[model samples]
Target: MTSVDITEARKTDAPATPVIEAKDLTRHFKVGRGFSRQMLHAVDDVNFSIGHQEIVALAGESGSGKSTIARLLAGVYKPTGGEIFYQGRAMSTFKSRKDQLAYRGDVPMVFQDPFSSLNPAFRVSHGILRSLKLHRPEFSRPQREEEAARVIETVGLTPAGDIMHRYPYELSGGQRQRIGFAQALAHKPKLILADEPVSMLDVSIRIGLLNLMAELRRSEGVSFLYITHDIASARYVADRLMIMYAGHIVESGPAESVLANPKHPYTDLLLGAVPDPRAPLAEGIEGDTGEPPKVIDPTPGCRFRWRCPLAIDRCHVETPLPRRLGENHEAACHVAEPDPGFRE
Candidate 1:
C-alpha cells in the first residue's frame, strides 16, 4: 500500500450504513495445564462497523488479534461472546444451512497469500470458474465464463483468456494476486475482508493493487475491512482507522486525525514506528519481546501494562474501557481520559 496520506474525502450521500457490524465480538481458546488452564482471549470485546462502500482499516502489531477477528468474521471460528450482524440482522438468526449460505454470499474474503489461496492442481481459469459457480450457482455455465473473464479483466489481467489457461505456478505474484481479487469480485459481494492482501507482493506491484481496491470502493460502492500492520499503508487505503493492541482497540478515528494526532501511548508508538525519510530514524516500535501472556484465566488489569511506558499502578489493577476523546475518536486508556491522574 502507498504511504502518502491524502486529505480525507467527505461522503455526499447519506452516511452509508454498515454492511458488517460486530458488537462486543469475542473469541476465546482454552489452553494451558492444570491450575494454569484458562481461556485464551484471542479476540476481546471488539466492536466496530464497516459501512457500505467504506473501507475500515484495522491496524495493529502481530498477535494484536486482527487475524483472529478476521477468521471470526469469515465464520471459520464462531465467537465465544457478543454478536455479529450483517446488514443489521443477527448472524445467528439464519436458521438453515441454506440461509447461512445466502448470508455469506453478501461477504467474501481475500487472503494474504494469493499463491496459497488458489489451488495448485487447477489452472487459473478453473480456479476462478469454480469460485464463480460456488458464489453464484444460479449463473449458467456460459454466464459464469463471461463473468470470470470480466472480473479477471477488471483486476487488470490482460487477455483474460490466455491468463486463465495458465496454471498458478506459471503466473507472476501480481498476476496470481489479481486472480485472487477476481475470485472475490466474481460474486459481486457486498463486503470484502482483506487480510494483508498486498503484503506478500513485490513492492512494484503493491501500489497498483492498493489502487485497485480503492477504485473498486469508489466505483462499485463495495465495503471493505482491510487488515494490515503497516500504518503507512493503512493511511492510504482507509476511510476510518482502528488501532489495536493486545487484542483491544486502543484508538479509532478518521485516518488523518489518528495518524496526525495519536491519543494513546500505544498508538503513538505505532505511528512513530512508520519509516520516515525526512525525520531521523530512531529505534522502531519493538516486536513482541516475550511470549503472549496466558490468555486463559488472564489478569483483569490492562493487557498492555507490561509494555506501556505510561503505565501507573492503576493500569496494573483495572481494565479500562473505551473513553471518547474527540469527534469520531475513542481510546481505551486511562491517561487519555478526562482525569489522567485519577489512576491513584
Candidate 2:
C-alpha cells in the first residue's frame, strides 16, 4: 500500500503566535578610515516571520548577508534599525541579561563549522551538560545526565554512552555536526538558527542532516531558519524560502512555488544555475554574471540591475519593494509579473 505524505496535511491551522519575527530589521557596519569611512550594509530592512514547527530557508551566495541576518536573530549582533519580536513580544522590552535569558533559552544557534564550534579539549558531553545547566536549572545532576544522553541519541548518535565520552577531535565531520544539533536540542529551543549547518559536510552526509532537521521539526515542534547557498538542499527540507542578495531580500514565498514560478529576474537566474542531475549541463548563464558590488552607503535603486537582464530605466532610479505574486508569495522586481503576464 502507498503511504500518504502527512506534512502538507498538518498545515491546516495557524500557530497561536509567530515563533519569531523581523520588522524591517537592519544592521550595518562602518568600514575604512575616518575620511574615507562608509557604512557597509550587512543586512538592510529585512522582514519575515517563522511560525511554529516550520522550516524557512534563507538562500543566497556567500557574501549575500544571509549569515548577518542569522546573527541578528541569534543576538550575536543587534539590529541597527527595526525590531525583532518573539512570540508577539518585542525584544527591546527584554533589556537585562536576566530578562533576555528566557528568550535566549527558547532560541539556540547551530554554527556552520561543527568541529570549530565544539571544544577540542573537553569530551562531547561538556557542551550539552553546560547548556542544560544554564537553560534547565530545574534538572538535578542525574536528570541532567539523562537529558544529555537523550538529546545525543535524538540527533541519531546512537547509544549516547559510546558518543558522550569522546572529544570533538575523535568524531568525524558528520558526527561533530550531529553534536551541534544535540547541543541545541538540550536547550529545547522553539527556533534554531542553523547557519549553513550542512554546507561543510560531504554530499551523502548532507541528506542525513537535512532529514534530521525535518525530524526535529516534526517530533519536537521546533522551527528553523536554515541558511544555505544551495537551493537544492533548501528545496529538500524547507517549507518557505527567502532569497537574499546584497543585504536585501529580493524574493520570498512558499519554497515550491517560488522555485516553480520565480517572479524576480535574480530568482530566475539563481534557479537556472542549479544543476539538474537528469539533464545535460548547459553553457554559462546568459546574464552579465558580474559580482554584486560592495554595498557601501548604497543609493536608492535596484541593486541587482548591474546583472539583471530585464532591468529598465525605472530599476536604475528606484528600489523595488516586494510585491505579492500569489498566496504568501512575493518578489522585489520592477519588470516581472504574476502568472499569465510578464511585462514592464
Candidate 3:
C-alpha cells in the first residue's frame, strides 16, 4: 500500500474551511403501516466537513447510511433535518436552478457500477460530449472532443481515440470505471462524491484506479468524499476517516489514527474485521457480525448498544455524546478509553 502523509494532509496551508459541510444532516423514511409505522433513520444527525483538496473516506458496512449521506451531499436527496453548506453558504437555500447548477458543477458523482452508470446506447465519446455540450456550450464540437480526449488520457485510458466509439459492454470493468472518471472530471469539479468507485472492479485493477484518484488529488486538487465498506482501501486513500453506523458518525480522525487506535467499539469492530493474511486471524464478533445495526424508529439511545461489546447500562439508556479521544479524533461512545498500544 502507498504511504500517505496524514500529518501534512491534516495541516492544510489554509485553515480548514469546509468546501462542503453538513450540520446535523439527516434523512428518515417512514416504514410500515400507520399504527405500526416506524421511521427508518437512514442518516441521523450526521455532521462533518470537507476542506479544500481533502479526501475524506466514509467507511461502514452496508446500511450504515454512508450512501444516503453521499446522496444528501450530492443534492440527490434532501435532508429531513439540519443544514448543508457549500463554501459557508447554505446549500439548502440554493433555490434557483441556475444556482444549483452552478454549485453542482463544482460537485459531481461517480457511482459504484460504472457499466450501469454509463449509457449503453451512447458511445463513450458521445456521452462525454453530451455533458460538455450541456455544461459548456461555448465549446464547439471539436473543442469538446479534444478536451474529452485529454480527459480520457488523464484517467489512464491510453490511446483514447480507440475507446471513443466503444460501448460500456465493450470495455473491461477497469476501463469502464476510467470512463466514469473521465465523465466526472469533464466538469473540473472541485469535489467528487465517489461512492465505492472501485468496489465493482477486478481486485488487481483497484490499486491503479486508486492511484489515479490520488494523482488527481495532487495534480488537480480535487476533494473527494470516498464512500466505501472496505476499511483497507479507506486506510489507503483517505486523508481522514469517518466511521458511520445506524445513520450516525461513530468515530472520525486521521485515517491512520482511527485505524491504529479506534476509540469507539464500533470502530474497533470495523478494524478487527479487516482481513490480514500475515497475522493469526482473531475470532470474529457474533450475532450478525459485520453488519450495521437496525435503524427502525430507534429509541433515544445508542444504536450499536445491541451489538457493542463495550455496551454498558448508560449505552442502553441514552445516546452517548461525541467524546474527544485524541487530537482531531473523536468517537461517539460512552466507553472510549484511549488504548495504550495505538499506532499505525
Q: Pick the candidate with the highest TM-score.
A: 2
Best by lDDT: 2
* Count of backbone collisions in candidate 2: 0
Candidate that beats the other on lDDT, 2 or 3, i.e. the better one: 2
Candidate 3's residue-wise lDDT over 300-319, tens digit each? 77899877766789987899
Clashing pairs in 3: none
C-alpha RMSD by candidate, in order: 3.6, 2.6, 3.1
Per-residue C-alpha lDDT of model 2 across residues 1-344, encoded as one tens digit per residue: 00123244224355778899999999999999989999999888999999998889999888889999988888889889999999998988889887688778888999999879999999999999999999999999999999999999999998899899999999999999999999999999999999999989999788889888888887888899999999988887888999999999999988888998889888888888888786666566778576575589988899999998888999989999988877778899899777654332
Per-candidate TM vs. native?
0.90, 0.95, 0.92
Stretches off by above 4 angstroms in model 3 are 1-14, 279-282, 286-292, 338-344
List residue ranges in candidate 2 displaced over 4 A.
1-12, 277-282, 341-344
Model 1: per-residue Cα lDDT over 299-334, one tens digit each: 887777777777789987889888777767788888
Clashes by residue pair, model 2:
none
Q: Please list the C-alpha lDDT of all candidates, in the order they appear.
A: 0.81, 0.88, 0.84
Sorted on TM-score, best first, the list reads: 2, 3, 1
